[model samples]
Target chain A: MALSPDDVARLARLARIDLSQAELEHLAPQLDVILESVAEVSKVAADDVKPTSHAIEIANVFREDEVRPSFTAQQALSGAPVKESGRFRVPQILQEDE
Target chain B: MSGLVLQTAADLAGLIAAGEVSAHEVVAAHFERIAQVEPQVQAFLALDEERALAAADRVDAKLAAGEKLGPLAGVPLGLKDIFTYQGLPCTVGSRILEGWHPPYDATVVKRLLDADLIIVGKVNMDEFAMGSSTESSAYKVTHNPWNLDYIPGGSSGGSAAALAAFEVALSVGTDTGGSIRQPAAVNSLVGVKPTYGSNSRFGVVAMASSLDVPGPFGRTVLDAALLHEAISGYDPMDSTSLNLPIPPVAQAARSGEIKGYRIGVVKELGGEGYAPGVLQRFNESLALLESAGAEIAEISCPHFTYALGAYYLIMPSEVSSNLARFDAMRYGIRVGDDGKRSAEEVMNLTRGAGFGAEVKRRVIIGTYALSAGYYDAYYGSALKVRTLIQQDFDAAFAKVDVLVSPTSPTTAWKIGERLDDPLAMYKADLCTIPANLAGICAASIPVGLSSENGLPVGFQIMAPAMADDRLYRVGAALERGVADAFGGPVLNQLIGSPAWDALSAQAVAARFPNIILGLAENLS
Candidate 1:
């Protein structure tokens, strides 16, 4: 519940967002206030209680493996930030220095 | 807004089907109204006038051929921007998706088109549907038509404001927490958050996947129900979609009879933190229902109090996971891909620059909550609370046919009033969040204006999962009661109220404010 600015920075890093120092300070106290309130849930719920991640019971749904009309590669890359020859152009995932 | 455009979706469809008016004329009339009033209201993000006219021409062509029409034929509609609509920009009010046009239509969009509903434009919303007020939108803040000074409730603010301002007869909105119902309550419209999974989420943007539900908003209960039926049913595209037949909401709405029905007033939702005027309107509605030959009583669902707390946890946790897809490269606007930085560095910088403050706050909270050591205390406990809330609904449904409450504790507030305070804004959803947690059906119908602020207030009705018809049965009856008691259109009663003082004729009197406010001219 006691979320310091450092902790918020760590969390933001984990979420893959590079927050400025000012944004971290601004968001930290607000998130702390929210966490303090929502922490009330932990107080009353007993360990014996079952958790519900989804509102309704989700049974697995299966479908026939049939070929259907699908988006072409051009259409799929239409909204992409960068594209190359029939593929997406993402930043390099590997380290060259290694 | 003219006489023809102000008519309900059902009435417009009737005229079109009866060969009285061409769909082109109806569509043109709405565009004329939009041209007149859009500057002040700012309800729509994009208006597809060219396509809307073409769609109308197609509908008229079918009618001239003596062919049967779609369920809601010829009515102009506003779509919430969260859904994918092929060539149209689907910005969920976030800069991250600024110029991105989805390649396909959401299942809801496809159904609306198939039903022959003309989509006039894409409406505004809170960025990623994260905020209660529409202020968090990357675009303009939509003003409540009743009074331009007040907020149109959000993240479905534009949808509600569109209906109130007569920009469109019916519109689509998705409720996560209280987005649809709260905005409906504050704006004086009929908004339904149908049973989760009743409407598919195939091409709809995901926030909190389990709780995000697309539904209909209209000026009347019957209109909402008609729109409801148009987009409700099973879809193979949405894996969690209900395989059962759509609940007969439209048919039940026409019944307008809750005689011999058991209606329960939720005990925990009221009495504290509720505005005095809101309580008065709520109590009067209870009495009105009693006079209509229904039995009412206080029903306690003890877990209702924890629903908001549980929701913030569960919703944000899902937000963290679902929004992970906006990683800069695949689609949407990318910020910091200078080529020297690694993929993770570019992603962090891009997400930091692209997302708004509220979206970042929730995603960070979500990441913290779901992180190691903290997961069990926050997200895990919230899930157990979710199970408890559902059990509470199951027990209450056994005791009563339907549950009723004041949709919001108060009416619409000024735009910036709660912006600085996230916790205070979250309380606006106390009465509506439980239904989302349980995946049950609920609706908010305008009962009266709140005397405290002279703003519109909504009466909420909730039904068990798959029993959504019960909400319509009671809502229609009460709507009739309010009409007779108030002596005109249900929303018309609020026109002369204090909220009208903001848009009064001291500037330019409406020969008919709701009808001719645009013609009123010089309106501030």
Candidate 2:
């Protein structure tokens, strides 16, 4: 259950939050303690026990898709920091690698 | 009309029904109160005078037309910003979704509207309901009304503080771990977190979907129960919402009989690590309840010792999954990345810039928990722990009709005391976490003030799932006993009636310098 520095670094990368050197150093030990604390939960839980996912037992509640009046195209772009031609404009994705 | 701020929603309704006061007059009085105290308290995030007045007019119109209105007709309510409304922004206190208006009202909001409750405004919260203190709020930290320098327990701090400050009669707040109860404890307000699925979560901005529940906040136990009764019950739009009929919570509150009830004081909670003053007040509350003809005894639930640890795991893991939808493409705020950069890069830049430090910490921990090679070691095992905790409550409830504990381990601490230490912040939730882990109903009632600091302490009451009414009955009786001994609800005696002039311009200037300057400039 021990998490290495590399594992911590990988998690930071996966979560997309840029961590400082101090944060990486601090988190390594804190996360280790947290893992150790939670590891105890694994002991008493049986293989026969069903995992509780939701506080209440629930299931799929889907609605049929239908055309409905929505915020105007202009209104949708109102809050954006950058926009163009009724669509959200972002940094380009295509490159020579393709 | 003299103490309408302290009157329960039921009493207010009766007054309105008898023509003692018009809905318009009530709304206007509350608005004047908000104008006075809101500057120092920062209880509301958004307030539309037009909407509140319009809603009041509609209620007055109904009465004039000779039509009977619903139970909470014209009663003003403050909504936690996390709950979605049709036009109002529901940010979850995260900049990533800033200014994003929901397409429709959350099911709980819709239910409140159906009951004719007036929405006074939206309240501030911890960013995406991530922290135990309101200091983690991105916009501004909410201060405890008891001591202006101390923190109001959060992420429902604004809702609790609103009740304490008398800015609103009632509010709806969501609790994932101890958001509602902890704040209520610190602010000396009555707050309830009903059994999971008792209220619908259809359009609430998700934090940890499995753990999140919407509940009521009020100045009195019966007020909270009446609000809870109006907003709870089945909603076809919410799959997780219980179809079972809700018990009459207000009726239970009116019943003073607890002679046959057996209340178990959790042996695990009132132990070492609790502030001495907090424990003293809690025992006093127990004595008051005992004097009211209820039998009190000790009970043990060993699994509770590890509830906080398991809660951090399960909640953050769900948070990682739930917040994934807020990428730069589909949502509010987006940061650009180079053309060669992957989608992950764009997501990272957006999230890293948008989220606060605590939120980032949780996202990293959650992502690690759900990572490919670590799923079994983290998320999977945490779910198993949750089931065991639920079973522990189930077994404990078999021996006792209800359980009791101190709502919080300590009174509200000074603002910066634990801000630098996240572990200490997480530890504050120790006494409150078990109820959330067990999916049981819990309420926090202010029992007495601490001798050392003169701050309030709350006693926690818990009941098994779907036995929320039992909590109301016990809590109401306890509230009456404690209040009678203290001469009043303590909160009201000190804060006094809400007034437009007492919340001085100097206090407002000191607390919200920039906001006042902006308002003055706008006026000039």
Candidate 3:
């Protein structure tokens, strides 16, 4: 249950949040304690019991296939930190090719 | 006559409807109060004075036109920042979304407007509703109205503090675990977390999709019920929204009868680790309920002990997924987007800078839990424990009409008491988490003050899902019984407290120095 700094770093990377070396070190022990404490869940979770994702049962809802009034492009882009031509502008994903 | 700002939501509604008070006057009174006390309480993150007055004017105009007003017409409400209000900043208490004005109103916000409740302002919260205390708010700390040094329990602390401080009679709050109820408990107000999915989460800033529920906070049970009725119902926008009629909670509150009702005390929630005064008040409330003809029994919810463990895992797992949408591109603060860095790198940098330490800790924990190899042992096991907790509720509810416990283990602690210890902070929600895990409705009403610290303690009443009315009935009955014993509401005791007087004087001096010599003088 001991979470290593490497594990903390990996988790931060997977979660898409950058962490400093100090944060990783500080969080590793705390996370290890939390994980060990929460690991109690495994002790009582019998195999026969079904895992519940939602508290109540919900089926996929369907609406008629028709156009509806929704957020306009302007509204959608209103809160975007970076926008270009009414679309979210993210940094380049592809590398330059020869 | 009581000042308009100090009047309960029900009384304000009545005054407005009877033409004894104008909505404009009520809104203005609250703004004055906010101006006087907000410096110390730090309850609000944003206040739209112009919009609030404009909204109030429309209510008055409607009344003048002889139009029927809703139950909460003309009442000002403090909206927790987690919900989107069109053209209003919805930070959800994070630096990432700071100053970001949402383009649309949340379903609940629209509903509140339709009910004619004026939005006073957006209140503060724990960052993304992640913490038990409001200390995690990136903006500012919200001090308890009773004692400036103690926390106004959170992550709905600001909403509860606003009510306790007489800044607003009603407010909206969200409870992922016990955000609304815990804050309500410590502040001696009524907080209700309705049945999961009973209220739409369409425009709410999602923390844990399954656990997050927007609820109401009021100075009285009836007030909370009235606000709950106004803001809750089915909505197509939220897939998980329950397709059912809104329960008659307000009616139940008015009736306030618990005759022939079987109320069970969950043996697991009390004793050991609970403050003596909290247990004392809880026992007193139970005795009162029994005197009012409620059949009390001891019920053992064996699996509830694992509830906190399961909730931390499941909540963070959902949080990690839900917050993944907060990448630098789509919204809020963006860092290092000079076009040279990759999107992923920018996203990482932005999130690291944007999220607070607690939020980051949860994301890391959740990432680890839902990671490839550990998924089954962590998230999967937690979900199964959730099932076990639900089964516990099912069995208990089968034997009783409602379950009762102290809302929180202790009264409001000092602000920095548990900030360094996350585990200690997490334990604050132990008694309230079962209801959320079971998707049932639960309410916290002021029972009495804790003898240990002289702060407020709350008695919790929980009912089965969709049977939300039962919670109101039990809460209203207990509220009546306690109020009768105290000769008034429990929070009325704070009126003469030296802490309140000192805090009020400080707040008044800090901001409204031109006004009365002492703001607490006017308050009393």
Candidate 4:
């Protein structure tokens, strides 16, 4: 339950959010306290108690592969920040020099 | 026609259907009222005048053709910004998705149009429904209609405020850990969180997917129930959406008979940290229910106390996962992608620049909780605790038909009072999170002004999943039982009537002083 700033920074990197040093300092303690408080769950979380991933029971919804009405390609690309040739455009995934 | 803005959805729908008032006029009246009070309330993120009037025209056309109208037809409704509505900026109160326009409608949005309700505008909320106060919004903070100085409880703050200010007759909001009910509690509006899967979430932006369920808000119990019925039905698009018949909520609301129905007072949700005035109003509401022929008893749900801890763990864990979609490649704003940084680096920078502090805090916590080595201790145990909480509800429901509690621990605080203290703010939903954990239905109906601060207090009611109508049934009876003493629901008198204009912010507290009895005495 004790979350250090370094621990938070590592998690932030994993979560794909680049947190500044200032945010790490400020939020780490807040998150640490939150964790310590939530850690109280360990007191009653006996192994006998089954875990509930969802409150309401639902099964994997299967459907036929039939085509249904959906967003047109034009509509699909409408909200894209960068697009070309009817596809989303992104920054370099691989460095050419490398 | 001039008093159209003040009329309930039921009244407006009746008038529109009976040809007493044109649907266009009704929509116009609400828009005009929005123009007047919106500056002070700051409830809306965007106003769609063109879309609203067009929808109104369609309703009018149906009437002209002598075709049957949909239920709640032509009534203006405020929508929470999280729901996708094509052609409007759906911010979800976050800067990351600022100016993002969804190309399609959420299933709930489509259903609202099908029901012939006019969508006035998108209302503000806590950024992605994370915070207790509306102050966390990237846009303006929504003020409570009862007192402009205090925070209207959030993350459904603006949805509650818009209706409470009478800008719209009905509004829609989603509750993930009491967003709808808490705001409804402080604003003196009726809000419902229908049973999980009872309503469709196909187009609602995901926030803690397991817990988030879109719901309805109104000035009265019946109005909320009527809106509830219109929006709730099975949709194949949502795997969790129950393929079952809609509960007869409006019918139950109309029948104010809870004779011999057993109600339980939740032992965990009250006392200790609860505000004295909030408890006073809750106790008074219990007396009303008792007099209305409902049997009441104290029911112990011991695991309920740990609901807040489990919710913070579960909700943010889901937030971290669900929000991973905003990678800046597909849609929304992309920052620092100036052809130099790699895609991963750009995604990190864009998210950092785009998200607010609260959003970052939650995502990081979610990441940490779901991370290996910590998953069993944090996330897994929270899941186990969730099972215990549901079991607690199951045992309680066996002895009682429904349970009651104060919707929120305290009335609305000042705008910035608890913002810095995240844990302090999280406690606002203390009494309401248990129902979400159990996936059961819950509602908050206006009781009266808290004696200490004079802010509105709401009485919380809970029913087993799929039995949502019971919340309406008991809420109606209690509302009727207490109606005469306060001259009506205090909310109806202060905001839902034409005379409300004179009771604006400062005037209301100075004029009424005591709860509604003082106003009733003055009116007499």
Steric collisions counted per model: 1, 0, 0, 0
Q: How far does residue B47 in candidate 4 sit from its true spot (Å)?
A: 0.5
lDDT of all predictions, in order shown?
0.88, 0.79, 0.89, 0.88
Candidate 1 has a TM-score of: 0.95
Position B418, candidate 3: lDDT: 94
> Poorest 10 consecutive residues of model 4 chain B by lDDT?
B515-524
Higher-ranked by lDDT: 1 or 3: 3
lDDT for each residue of candidate 1 in A1-98, tens digit (9 for 90 to 100): 47888999999999999899999899889999999999999976899999998887779899999999999989999888889998999998988976
Query: Residues A5-54, candidate 4, lDDT per residue (tens digit)?
Result: 89889889999998899999898899999888888887889999999989
Which portions of model 3 miss their true places by more than 4 Å? B507-524
Any residue pairs clashing in model 2, and if so which?
none
Which pairs of residues have clashing backbones in candidate 1?
A: B505-B509
lDDT of candidate 3 over B27-115, digit per residue (tens): 98888888777888888888888888899999999999999989999999999989998767778889888667788889999999999
lDDT of 1 by residue, B261-379 (tens): 99999999999799999999999999999999999988999989899999999999999999999998888777667777888888888789779999998999899889999899999
Among these predictions, the greatest DockQ belongs to 4
Candidate 3 lDDT at B505 equals 77
* Model 4 TM-score relative to the real fold: 0.95
lDDT of 2: 0.79
Clashing pairs in 4: none
Q: Ten consecutive residues with minimal summed lDDT in candidate 2 chain B?
A: B515-524
lDDT string for model 4 (B356-429, tens) is 88999999889988988889988999999999999999999999999999999999998889989999999999
Each candidate structure's TM-score, on Cα atoms with residue i matched to residue i, is 0.95, 0.91, 0.96, 0.95
Against the true structure, what is every candidate's RMSD? 4.9, 4.1, 4.8, 7.1
